[model samples]
Target: MNYTAEAPAVWDPEAFTDAEDCLLCADQCVVRAQHYFVKGMIEIPVIGGDETFSWGVWVSISRDSFSRAADLWDTPGRESEKPSFGWLTTDLPVYPATTLNLKTYVHTRPVGERPFVELEPTDHPLAVEQRTGISLDRVREIAAAVLHAGEDAQR
Candidate 1:
């Protein structure tokens, strides 16, 4: 699933906040209020065959979390690394859940350059969703649904 932009999708702050329940907190949380949304694809190698599939991915996270995670990635002799918190939704059959560490296997360039995040190969269904292409509208819809589901679960 190559990351070709299907259509432009605007961020609905109100819907996102409602689904994420941002109002429940006394103070603003970076993960809920501020984060980077991105879409991309990864090539997966198949065993015993010369075949590969382009897996599309959708992710969002705050700069603070990304920086903190990057610091941890560089730090030596660290007891344990903190998982950079964020949303990791995707369009792959192997992945179903939409919760993942946004910092895992990430890549980026200078300030003026475009940022991209790569998903690490894992057997666990971590932050994976069954879908194709990179549609901001689809991403927003999924986020809304997931967050809304969370909100409903709490009620």
Candidate 2:
């Protein structure tokens, strides 16, 4: 299952005032040319199922880190690069607590695929779910939530 976010939580590229300073594309983002971010997938394996459920999220990286990732973006064997540390910028609504600012590691994937984001082991429900796995029912719940959210937006 693949559900992706268009941008980081609470940051609207459409409403951004400083167009010159902020950049938000489908895969990469930079705010004020200082705060750098990259889109990645945080996948949760389905219990007793062969597939996975993923949240298309963003991770905030440093300027140097972003530069390194950018340099390797189109280069072959970029997946061989070590995972870069960053903070999770997406806010997931499925959990009660805020999902923002969690520690994470972003691993570059092969060409045409977004990076993979692994959250730091923590007591948070999302982290626990990532460490372990979620149920098919959980996936249905997430799907229903997302569908309703999209419907709400259209209203």
Which runs in model 2 stand beyond 4 Å of their true positions?
A: 14-18
Alpha-carbon local distance difference test for all models: 0.41, 0.89
Error of 2 at 8 (Å): 1.3
TM-score of each: 0.35, 0.93
Runs off by more than 4 Å, candidate 1: 1-33, 64-87, 91-103, 109-117, 120-122, 125-155
- Please name the candidate that would achieve the greatest lDDT relative to the true structure: 2
Q: Residue by residue across 46-128, what tens digits does model 2's lDDT show?
A: 99979988999999998988999999888888998899999999988768899999999999988888999999999999999
Residue pairs with colliding backbones in model 2 are: none
In terms of TM-score, which candidate is strongest? 2
Please give me the total number of clashing residue pairs in predicted model 2: 0
